[model samples]
Target chain A: MRSSVIIFPGSNCDRDMDVALKKFGFKNQMVWHNDQSIPKSDLIVLPGGFSYGDYLRCGSIASKSKIIKSVIDFANSGGLVLGICNGFQILTETGLLNGILQQNKFLNFICSNVYVKVKDKQNKYFKDLKKDLLELHIAHNEGNYFCSDDELKSLEDNSQIAVTYCGVDGTENEKTNPNGAIKNIAGIFNKNKNILGMMPHPERMIDKYLSGEDGSLFFKNILDNFK
Target chain B: MKIKVIVTLKNGVLDPQGKAIQQTLNGMNFGNVEDVRQGKYFEIEVKEKDEKKAKSLVDDMCKKLLANLVIEDYKIV
Candidate 1:
């Protein structure tokens, strides 16, 4: 499948994403953030990193980059966009996705692999995967996601709440909730429901036994519906 | 005229950095801290002397790039 990843000046995960995509058997193009166009692809990923040195706020400045206009247009056209870590923040800042990403409630940088339970499998991204539980690595200092009460209710009511932080035993992990998200949400999808933005790095856990390959299926689920 | 631009998080918005600083200061025994919120400042010296035009430029800069406007609010003083 054709794939592309956007790279901003401070993006440190660009290479990691490229390697992950390659390991997934897809050779993808790395699109620069300044380009005012989205390269044709089945998937577009905004990888994790401190874009624009996290100036002003996490993912705030990068949202106004030249290429964001195109990304917004792309998402409006029903295109698939996945924002990981800072990418998730950027998406929110750009208003391509709902809510705002604030700093972790703990006032510290969390670098541990996090467990995420799939809250919704009715969508193509996780349609085949059982909605029981899954695991992915989350590395971020500003991963706390917040939205207005009404908007939070709408997100839940529509099953757009894709993933939440949970212990390996299938219970919510309060300490690891990190940012005290409204409902331990680690990832979410837009109203259009096609675009997804998540803080956990599925790309970091796609290898079998190594990362248990639990996250690889997330990609396969996408490939299944796309190609 | 020199104008000070103050950018701050909106009400009810979480400010982790601000909270951290507040705790640090309080821990050092600095009392009388009511509330704390983080903000940014931009001291711009502009060539345009017309208040209307300078104000318009600053607004445009904030709207087009300087500010996210989604979660941040900025004012020129």
Candidate 2:
């Protein structure tokens, strides 16, 4: 599958996503944020990192990038988009996603391996991946996912809530959730269910037996979805 | 000609930065800290001399990129 990853000035995870896409057998290209056109691609991935030094707000400045307008158009045209970490914040800022990345309620930046509970396995991004426990690293200060009550209710009702933080036994606790994100959310899908934004760095854990390669399934899921 | 645009979060949207600023003011014993909502000041110097056209263009810029209509508002002065 063809994919493009957007690289903003301060995006540190662009290469990590490039490496992950290479593993997925995709002809991946890195698009600069200032470019007004998006490469013709099946999937667009917005990598993580402190875009524009996370200044003003995490994704505020990056969302105004010229390429982001095309990304928004791509989403409107039904193309798949995935935003990780700062990428997630950009999606919200651009109105592609339905929430904002508020300051972590704990008033601290969290950087560690976190355990996530998969809520859906039917989506293209989660195919071959069972609704099971996943260990991934999350690093960000503005990782808090905030939405209006009505929007959250709609997402929950539509089964768009994709991933949540929880213990190994399946119970969600505030402590293990790390950022005190509402409903322990680590990720979510857009209204069309094609776009996804998550805080955990799946690209950071793609090697099995080492990080158990849990992140590999995410790419595999996308590659095999072309059918 | 110069026009200033101030953009701020709309009511009910949480402004943590504004809250922090307000807290600092309260700590400083500023009795007149009625409210504090953080906003951006965009100092625009447009070559257009028509006041009507300048106001309209500035408003368009604010709508398109300066402010997020969903959760924020902007004023041109």
Candidate 3:
């Protein structure tokens, strides 16, 4: 499979995504944010980092970058696009996903490993995955996801919610919520389920020694589904 | 002409920074403070000389880039 990881200015996790994608048998390419076009690929990733110094709201500026037009067009065509961490913020800013990621309810940057329950497996991203919950790393200040009540209802009704913060036992509640995101939403899919925007960094957890292997399962699962 | 605008989180949206500030103020003995909310202000110098045109341009900017309508409201001041 082929993948592309867009590198915005100050995108710290782009290389990590590149590594993760390649390690999982994907031929990956790094695309720059200023480029007007992207190479054809099966998957495109907006990786984590403080894009545009998180100015004017996190991911707000990067969402308007020259390359994002092509990204939006690719998404509109039903291509798979994944946004992780700061990338998730950019996706929401671009209107590709619902809601905005506001500052944490406690007013602090949170960096930790949290359990995320796969809310929907009908999509390519998490389909056929063995585990119902996965341990992933989340590092961000603005990870509290909020949306209008009507939008939330529509998402729930459509099974657009992809993941929710939870415990190892798959219990989702306030204690497992890291940033106070609405309904403990850690990630969501567009109505079509081709686009995924989530706060956790699966790329950061792909290694068994460094972090854990659940992220390995995530990457491998997507590649398998594509094949 | 310069267009001045204020962008604030929509009513009922949680504002953690504002809450922190409110708590700090209360700790400083500003006891009557019931609540606080944070917002952003922007001043844009538009090329249009007409006040109406300048305001309209800024309004578009707010909608497209300056403010996210999902969680924020922008007002021309």
Docking class of 3: high
- Winner by TM-score: 3
Alpha-carbon lDDT of model 3: 0.94
Candidate 3: regions farther than 4 A off: none
DockQ value of candidate 3: 0.95
Candidate 2 reaches a DockQ of 0.24
Interface RMSD list for the candidates: 2.3, 2.9, 0.6
Model 2, which residues run further than 4 Å from truth?
A34-40, B21-36
> What is the number of backbone collisions in each predicted candidate, taken in the order shown?
0, 3, 0
Considering only chain B, report the TM-score of each candidate against the true chain B. 0.86, 0.88, 0.97
Model 3, A187: alpha-carbon shift in Å?
Answer: 0.1
Candidate 1 residue-wise lDDT, A86-205, digit = tens: 899989888888897777888778888778888887776887774477778888888888888888999988989988998888788676576677689899999867788999888888
**Highest DockQ, which number?**
3
Residue-wise C-alpha lDDT for candidate 2, range B1-77, written one tens digit per residue: 89999888888877777877888899999968977888888899888999889888889988766776656788886
Candidate 3 residue lDDT tens string, A84-178: 99999999999999999999989889999999999999999999999999999999999999999999999999999999999999998999998
